[model samples]
Target: MDPADVLNVRFHYGGEFIRIGPSLDYVGGDTAMSVLERDKLSLPELKGFLADHLTVKDSMKIYFLMPGRQLVNGLLFLHTDEGCMQMSEHITDAGVADIYVEYNGEQDEPEEDASGSDFEDELDDLMDNDDEPDAVITAEEEDIVQGNVQAVNAVPEQDILEHILVPNEGGVVTEIISSPVKHNIRVDALSQGSLPRLSRF
Candidate 1:
């Protein structure tokens, strides 16, 4: 995959976190203007790349590399529909400049449980039993399931960005780097109104 397509992307390598940004290019002619060139990837491409490359498991603590080679700790969550969109928005808004992925080794597999086979057999038996009445889930149970789904789908974009932008302890929320042209203006306008300013850096 092209390195220019991703922004502020992180991957685990050799037990360390690696941050990636867009590729740089020079503009044609004598002007000698440097340009940040980024390539865009579709959802399928992104998913496929992640599936093929990422080694760390979901919710793993990973490092994010800053401009000055500073490393900060952050949690890595599995990408969902909302998460993918949020990540894309963050990369664009943050004006990230580099992007790359490296695979150093195979991912560590989860430990096997002794009762796993028995549990699978039981589940299969339950599925094969046609004479048994189907188990009916209650309304409350359905609501609980729906709530869990929503929770999983709700990508905490602000929290993740805040962690990335302001890594020091006791750092003020306002210290985060807001999207210079769009988010900051909207936040300033809202601050002027009845609503208090909610930082979106």
Candidate 2:
């Protein structure tokens, strides 16, 4: 892909977390920490930075060097008050423990009204129960009705892709790997930044 063609990309971000994906130029043997080291970041300081300042809310986009078949070494760019900084490596690690916070963007169509009118009446009964003065609730019942109200309680998806690794201390990334995606490989936690909101495109 032409470097210019990659422009206009959208990043997903929330309060702190940002949305990211594997770049188009992932090398076969790269990790978060390794990239950080390559960039001359100090590992110890990087750890302190993450501990001191990092928050991963749901829907935060994080770019990573995808292992295996899909890998690339595309420029991972971030917009900041100073301007844009395009890193040659992918964002390997984040402070938040959750690696990926995917929401139901395109849900599977509800099992085509399998219960028909009976389903409708059951749903109505459940709705009426919500108004009951003191209705006994069970875990099973809650699960059954999750579809009806989960969206209201669902966390809003992160809407920006730009992030900043504000180095409270400053350090480097050594390794980073997703277990399900890459088994037994301990991916390093790279430096964390204070990602500001901006146009990822």
Worst 10 residues of 2 by lDDT: 26-35
Model 1 misplaced stretches (Cα beyond 4 Å): 1-10, 14-45, 51-76, 97-201
Error of 1 at 130 (Å): 44
lDDT of 2 by residue, 67-120 (tens): 222323422222231112132232223311111112223322346555578878
Q: What TM-score fits each model?
A: 0.23, 0.16
RMSD of each: 40.2, 44.1
Cα lDDT tens digits, model 1, 1-201, are 344454544433334233455432212212111122234434444444445544434443322223333233323232344544444554553454222222234445678865579888788888888896979999999999999979755745453332225445766554445433343334666576533223454
**Model 2 ranges off by over 4 Å:** 1-57, 64-84, 88-119, 122-201
